[model samples]
Target: MSTAPTLIFTEALVLLGGAVVAAPIFRKLGLGTVLGYLAAGAVIGPLAHIITGAEEILPVAELGVVFLLFVIGLELKPSTLWRMRADIFGLGSAQVLLGGGLLTIAAVMFQLLDWKAAVVAGFGLSLSSTAFALQILNDRNDMNSAYGQRTFSVLLFQDLAIVPLLAMISILGNQAGSQSASLWMDIGIAIAATLAMILTGRYVLTPLFQIIARTGAREVMIAAALFVVLGSAMLMQAVGLSMAMGAFLAGVMLAESSYRHELEADIEPFRGILQALFFIAVGLSVQFNVIFDNLLLLALAVPLIMLVKGLSIYGLCRLAGSSHNDALRIAAVLPQGGEFGFVLFTTAVSAGLFSNATASLLISIVTLTMALTPVVASLANHLLKGEAREEIEEDFEGAGSDVLMIGFSRFGQIAAQILLASGRDVTIIDDSADRIRQASMFGFRIYFGDGTRLDMLRAAGIEKAKIVAVCTQKRDVTDKIVDLIAAEFPHCRLFVRSYDRVHSLSLRARNVEYELRETLESGLKFGRSAITALGVSEDTAAAIEDDIRRRDEERLQLQAVDGLRAGTHMLYNRPVQPEPLVKPKRGAEQPEDAL
Candidate 1:
């Protein structure tokens, strides 16, 4: 009997049970699931010792980060990265160099470590947690915003920055001779591996998916998705780059594939579970004893490091021409220690730059910062001027058309098609990146912009357009765009999509040239088709539909003057019979038939 199997089962059970119990409770408490998982891991592993070997679990759990990067990569096309070059190179470089320099100075001024160790530690701590920051952004649905893009660009540069920083540790350490040469060799290998992945993804992946899809076996497709993600991850790991970097490259390669959405759908479940496990694993790895021993020192150090990093990022974003709100958001999202810090610190310890105790103390500090990130971010919300929203550049290169459509959501999408088919030049704009990408694949040219902004509206050619169609999904958003247009471009005709009966009345009050309730036409058509299917002829059905439409218009006009409940009698209803006593009458009718 192998007790090893039982131990493994017990650990799995404990982890699953802990996650199940903790995530919801913390979510209900408004602390977020990341913190919940951390709390649960802390209780089960460090405090109670219900589960052991967290260190061993960490390597396996890091797959969560790898999958997360892969999913993010799917959302970004290479062209999108090209568009973000200035931020990635210029802003990212400044943050790392200046931020690392500031932290190094702080460490040295305090006599925290020797010069060699301080250099490594400073840069290491300058790196913020990609997993933690991204999770926060994703939960808030802000990953595609201007600030989010800038934040991600900085994190990406940090990931690239790790290689050189690691090389610097080799040159500064006691084992400089062998480690330096090995580090250079590893760099070469990483470059070659990256190139290989690019070629394989370009030439092999799409066709492979095509063949598998032809087979119509959904399970095989899922396995293939997993294989591609894990295989790319392992290749990068083999060449000394982070596994996440490789998976991201693979995702970028496949970004233009027609199957991109399907692939995302396939990988999402695995990414979610693994990501949760990764957060829990972070919690389990918390060294409470070390934290307690250095409580006073860390109390000073953690906030100092976060402050230095946050101020540096905030300053750099402002200088780079970001709005004050965006700068504040970028600062709030990234002012914590990163997962890569653990790798750098442990490496420094091995190279004789720092002792084991020092590494433990740094690790403890990072863990505490990771746990505190959500709270710090929450605090940042109070400091923002207004509700923060994701914004994209308003490009109107070929705009200024006959019809300007404000939103490319489902309603707008359908309306645009009708306009296009009728040979109308319609300019479409939408704020959703996913919708933009999907629409682009189908040959739709949509400008990325928020329609509520007057500048964005002007750029999209509201003044030149004969009609401005407001087709935003949300009622409030639609109202805002309509109001802005009515106020700013009063001469322009407005065609608005109404949410419901009440909304139709409100839009009418706003004096739009045209307003149609979103579901009214569809509901009427469905009823007509259903009646035609049962017994009514097509001509009769058409007449019935026309009658209903006329009655509805009449009802709306009456309701507008008399209030919502004033037109109830216009709706058709079956009349009730008060009494029917036909038994004796039936006998009288039988007598007539007999005669």
Candidate 2:
């Protein structure tokens, strides 16, 4: 056997290669790059045996999870998390309890396991893949949808749940002795560590980052951020908690800090590569032969586990006041065992709570279920067809609007607010119940339904509406809405917000009258400020903007024509066509010689 160090290097190289090769193919297949990573890991670890030392690869893989959790933490502001309290606390709590409890019962019955073992199994199996679900939702442009928000809420709760779960696991390990004090001590240490980190982070990290940023040394900032993550992780581990928990807390601490955006940008590339490696490591760890041997048991357990979790999630979503269709959608998306479940399950086996055979069985089941999620989501889409239509119609009929905003997000909200203030009747439609409630609180009328669906558009007064604005986060959904508007509401002026340049071009192809890249306007604002700072007169700056605007309008008209012929209208950065400084009536301008 090769030395551990050599094995580690070999495995890392293999994983890197796999990710590079598989990602593009998966993208082309419309399956997403995540699936590509999984496929790569599966091929190298199990099928090809490129990296034989799976155990040595585990820790490196775990770094991916840590980075991913950290990024997730950075994105969540306290206010946003607080607003999702109902879904996170209420529905999330129910999902963990009910799903875990039922799974525990089944484990006891089928595997004839001890109560402690069964409980561990149950709790472990209850989680759905946050990484997988989030990535897919992001791909589909549904991350800001009502269903997406609820899904994220539940995932956030699950991430937090790891704390108590770890504590309980430690407690369960010492059940033979009166070790309650140790559990309490562990919990106390964890809380203290988290508080200390938060306080220190608030006072120190941001300033430190600002100093580093001013130097314009990218590597220094990267190193400082890494130190924070690794240091926090080490401290948590010293306190007998998981490194992941510490990473998550650190992220939350930085979420509202001034340097949050900078920190995120620096950490993102590392997070992506590490997370992909982590997924690959998971693939490598799977004992495919063992799964084949216990195929019957694995098959029985997988479906039953998915069914229980799905039903529990669906019930909780409904109880949390989600529409039936949305509840069903949540159920479909989250029925599988999550990445955390695999981690917990493997830990239990290593701790002697489960046999190697059983661990392999459970892993196999979880893997199969996770693999099935995209297919399940596709099925849910078909099942929930037409439901969005009825809801949209009812909402629009009630609003009696002449203009419809499909997504009541930041951009959409501003547009709706301005129009409403201008005495224009506007109907707002969004998928997030929380957003809708908040809008209602602010006296803005909003409806809940998928905006991409034609039924929802009609329900939102599509035919009567003179304008439609697609300003959601998802490009695909935006494109879909644009197409629908062009087909059905041909006269309705279409305005869309694209996530990036590519999305803007896609919208332009659909002959959208107004397409704005979300960041472009902000970039232009910055450019104007810079020009003014550089001693350009305010009038000159304004004229320059006007000139650029005129060119952009002309480009849009040209793009519309190009879009009709081909599916894309590519924009190039060329010098704007210089306009005549002054114009005279035809045949009225004097020749230079005459002058």
How does each model score on TM-score? 0.71, 0.70
Worst-scoring 10-residue span by lDDT in model 1: 586-595
Cα deviation at 140, candidate 1, in Å, is: 1.1
lDDT of 2 at 546: 56
Among these predictions, the greatest lDDT belongs to: 1
Global lDDT for candidate 2? Answer: 0.76
Worst 10 residues of 2 by lDDT: 586-595
Off by over 4 Å in 2: 1-10, 111-114, 141-146, 163-175, 214-216, 385-564, 568-595
Q: Model 1 residue 20 lDDT?
A: 94
lDDT of 2 by residue, 431-521 (tens): 8877887888888878787887877777667777777778888877777778877887788898888887556666766677788887767
RMSD of each: 10.3, 8.0
